[model samples]
Target: MGEVTINNIQKDESGILKENKKINALEDSVENVEVDGEKYDLTIDGYINMQESEEYTLFLRKSTSGDNYVLTNALLSKYPVEEEEQDELFLEDGESLEETEDLKDTYQELYQEVLKE
Candidate 1:
């Protein structure tokens, strides 16, 4: 006869997870590095509030689907940063609804008058 035994083990519950409103904001910190006779400071964003034991590496490359660059790193510099535009989308309140309707009617009447002219 064979002996039977059961053992239970618990998993580690410590790790970084993605949060909806708790995204890590990247800080762009460019510094010049002397390589041979030339000096260059890479434009990149530094990670904020990251653990020290985490192992990772930053990557600099062009996006596969678009013409842009991205930087990925943790602390001091890390993550992809893209060039984008900030445009507000809204309607202008130059005229009220009734005034706008009147303007439209006036435009039609003006077109008729011009035709007569």
Candidate 2:
């Protein structure tokens, strides 16, 4: 087992929680931060979309038996900006995900099958 570094923890003037942490390799696995545009993202279920320039107040809990931290209340712990306040971050002139009907789906289907087992 290995450990990652948690450096700084503070809040911005807008009350958004900010953290400076370095992801280190766990066991033999390599780790790094994922950045899209100007935003940082942590892969959750490998399906949740990461919005650029989005801010959230994340409530996290460190694992009692491992070197990991997870959202305290699934997604309820991470509250995004109000819809009105998020309008600018999503200016129509900037980047966007094109509408598509076909795409890869992960976990959800398999989870349903497993549940029926």
Candidate 3:
């Protein structure tokens, strides 16, 4: 697996309130994202292993401990980026990527939010 530098996003006051709104209905929408760092530990699920030199599109979230990052889910989160093998969804089954629209949307949107920092 290649190393990808992560950039952390600190929440603004509005962002924090947005999170609270989810639990208390304080905001109409959620726009905040979890922070990341250049280097941190990775917590992976045992269903598959990441290999060196392979390109992947991974969706990661900060763990509750606020230290290491969590791979969103085992199969659905780690996407192999090889153009030829793009047809393959996952090694085994749970749900296809297309089926996880909300997750993809969450990560995609969060990623964009992070980039704004």
Best-matching candidate per lDDT: 3
The TM-scores of all predictions, comma-separated, are: 0.18, 0.30, 0.34
lDDT of each: 0.31, 0.36, 0.40
Candidate 2, run of 10 with poorest lDDT: 99-108
RMSD of each: 24.5, 13.7, 14.4
Q: Sort the predicted structures by TM-score, highest score first.
A: 3, 2, 1
Is candidate 1 or 3 superior in TM-score?
3
Model 1 CA lDDT for position 87: 15
Candidate 1 clashing pairs?
46-77, 71-79, 72-79, 73-78, 73-79
RMSD of 3: 14.4
Instruction: Assess the local accuracy of residue 99 in candidate 1 as a C-alpha lDDT between 0 and 100.
Output: 50
Candidate 1, 5-109: lDDT as tens digits = 112112213333222212232324334567897875553221132224432223333335453333332222221122111111111334446754554455345
Q: Alpha-carbon error at 24 in model 1, in Å?
A: 50
* TM-score top scorer: 3
- Which pairs, if any, clash in model 3? 1-51, 1-52, 8-36, 21-26
Per-residue lDDT over 5-105 for candidate 2, one digit per residue giving the tens place of the 0 to 100 score:
43345333533333565332222112255566454434322223224455443445555656554555432343343332323322233333432111112
TM-score for predicted model 2 compared with the true structure? 0.30
46 Cα displacement, candidate 2 (Å): 14
